[model samples]
Target chain A: MSAFYSVLKRELRSYFASPLAYIILVVFQVISARFFFLYLQGFLQFQLDPSYQLQTGDLNLNNLVILPYFGTISIVLLLIVPLITMRLIADEKKNYTAELLFTSPIHIRTIVLGKFAAALILLIMMLLLSSVNVFVLMVHGNPDLGAVLSGYTGLFLLGASFLSIGIFASSLTDNQLIAAVISFGVLLVLWLVGALSDAESSILGYLSVINHYEDFGKGIVDLKDVVYYVSLIFLGLFLTYSALESERWR
Target chain B: MVYVHNLTKRYGNLTAVENLSFQLERGDVLGFLGPNGAGKTTTMRIITGYMPPTKGTVHIEGVDIFDEPLQAKRVIGYLPENPPLYNDMTVMEYLSFVADIKKVGRKEKKSRIFYVMERCGIAEVRRRIIGHLSKGYRQRVGIAQALVNNPSVLILDEPTIGLDPRQIIEIRELIKSLSGDRTVILSTHILPEVTMICSKVIIINHGKIVLEESLQKLSEDMRSAESILLRTRQNGEGVVEKIHALGNVSSVKPGAAGEYIIVPRKGAEVREELSRLAVENDWGLLELRPVTNTLEEVFLKVISSEGN
Candidate 1:
């Protein structure tokens, strides 16, 4: 347990020691905040226009602003999470620090778990920073608090899944850029796989990472959606562990 | 104590280490000598539990590394060819991190870090970032990190490769001082380092150990008067035949600059007779020296013999 915490602490410290983490946080906040304001503007425009208001009798702030805001930010996270996770294991290999970790009296599972936990914590912090925009709606307007909480939950799961994929990709290569590119490609494919089929029961729809996330946007924390995201996280980390283990044999 | 039995590692069809076996009692410092691509690093990695061999078992302090790597690794410290360092971390932070992973007690961690820093002579730069330190300092930090756990077995691969002459001597002296109770297996391209630090030497060639012997025995065998060099002032016509005719000298080959290489019979002492012969022929004996086989020559000889 101490070994696991040590790795986690070192990884978090490493993230803060570099300029990349701060740059990522600032960039994510700026871009997500911009998208939030755009959604708020659209909601305001709909409230002022009589024809629009007549077509949709009541404009729920949760549906008008928060749902779309979370939706666009999920896409932004898809683009940004790779940057956060690319160097987790890749830099270790590049600098030969992986040797230090592997030779130490710690299990591979412990190292992987520690690194995953650190990245998840950073992702959570990123989400919390982005949520300040949603808090504005809650302050001045009456947005469904339950829906906003569920939306945040869904965003956390989605980001966690993306980060798992990124760490797995990072484990496959020592080059951080290649790790980032591979993870981005994998995340993009999983996000679009659901588009291949209209029926939600289809295997493609079931496999799409983003499809499971829609329930969270609607303020629904479906057990099925949670299970899917959790399973994806497990699969990604399992693959990473297998990759690291096989590296010894090779 | 450490024992490696029939260790073999194959990557696809290429074998990096083949049927290698050796043993070390407590306090033994083994010198691992080999040319490039000789599988020294591969063997070290396996013993340190960094990598699993395709066929073999390594036991450190009676713990089978393959069966329980964590238990085995807890007693081992390794410094790879390239020092594993986090560039952004300060020396103190890096050592603290190592101490944490190695599971040093919370109270002992601080003192252990300070002890290693002091031993490796990096205490003055403990607060400096690892990346900003010089290469010599970085290597010292590497050694310090390896020692933070106070491991029983220390495996160092090319620890002195990139250091200056002074730094190499300092590191060698430090290693020498470190070897009383701790077992050390150090691999190096420098032959003299083996003579200076190792009690036993293992020379590997093509994934196999070609020679393993104690330093005292190896030097003894090397010093047994197999040949001698005789340098005289004149061109020394017929000196080879004359020296060979002296009975104890088996054969003499004339060399450049009026020199003759005399090979003597086993246990022969021909120096006195050679001097007499040179004086009788009025050949001014400029130099007479016994040719001792250096570790370099023995290493090359063993490697070449293994190659054939």
Candidate 2:
């Protein structure tokens, strides 16, 4: 436990020491805030236009401003998660510090978990920082609190899954660019896999992480969706552990 | 405290180490001597449980390294050719992390880190980032990290490479001061450090152990009466005949600078006899010295002899 904590602490410090972390935060805030403002503007225009509103009067602010905001941020996270984690293990290998971590008594699982946890914590912080948009929704209009809460929950889980993929990719190489590219490719596949599934019972739809994330965008926290994200996170981390172990053997 | 048997490592068709075996007891500071690409680093990594050998067994104390790596690694502190430092971390934080991973208890962690820092002479830079420190200071921090967890065995591979002479001496002295009941294995291609610090030496070339001998015995064997140089003021009368007549002198030839290059018999004390012969004949004895073989020559001889 102490080993896990120490590695976690060091990893977080490294993230803060580099400008990349701050840059990612600013990027996320700017993009998500832009989407939120656009949705709010569209909602106001919808209310003012009698013809446009008579056609579709069922539009709500929670759906208009908050749900799409969370959904858009999740897509942005697909890009940001890779940048955040591309160097976690890959840089360690490049710098030869993996030798230190490997030779230490800490288990490979602990090392992987420490790095993943640290990155996930940063991702969570970035997600929370964008809640200013949510508070803005709260100040001006009545928003669905349950939907907002579930949306944040889904965003955290989705980010965890993306981070796991990044962690696995980082373990496969010593180059950060390759890790980032590989992670983005994997996440894009996960995001697009649902389109090929035309049936509700199809395994492809069940496996599509983006599919599970949609319920959270609708303010519904299904136990199955939570379980899917948790299991995917586990599988990704397990693959990372195996990747590190195989590297030692090679 | 360390035993390796028939260790072999093969990377596809290339064999990095082959059938190499050695053992060290408590307080024995063994020097692992080898040239570049002699598999020193591979062997060290295997013993440290960072990599597995193709065929071998390494026992630390009594535990097999491959079978019980975590348990074995708990007792070994390894410093590779390049120190594995987190550049963003201060020395104090790095050492603390090392201590934690090495399983030092919370109650003992602070004192243990402090003791290692003081011993390694890195206490003053404990608060500075490792990347910002001088190379020598970073190397000392590397040693400090190895010592932080109070492991029973220490493995330092080429610890003094790329240091100024003054820093090398300081590190050498530091390593010497560290010797006690703890086992230390320091590897280097440089020969002088072996003679200066190690009690036992293992010379490996081409993935094989060419020689393994104590420093005293090797030094003694290296200092035999094979060749000598002599010079005298009176070079003419009866001097050559009298010196030649000595049973120890096999052949004598005039060398440059009015000196004699004398070869000795199988086992002889030519220095004492030649000095006496010069004095008895009133030939001024300007210089009498044995020409010992250099370590480079010895390594060449050993490798060639093994090759043939």
**Top model by TM-score, which number?**
1
> Candidate 2 versus the native: TM-score?
0.94
Interface RMSD of 2: 1.3
Give per-model TM-scores. 0.95, 0.94
Q: Candidate 2 has which clashing residue pairs, if any? A: none
Which candidate has the top score in lDDT?
Answer: 1
Whole-model lDDT, candidate 1? 0.92
Residue-level lDDT of model 2, residues A1-250, one tens digit each, is 3889988988999998878889899999999999889988998997788776566544888877787788899989998999999999999998788888889988999999999989989988898899988987788789889988889999999999999989999999999999999999999999889899898679998889899999998889999999999999998999999998877777
How do the residues B215-289 of candidate 1 rate in per-residue lDDT, one tens digit apiece? 999998998745899999967667777887889777788888888888888889989999998988999999999
Identify the CAPRI category of the predicted complex in candidate 2: medium
Off by over 4 Å in 1: A51-58, B235-248, B268-282
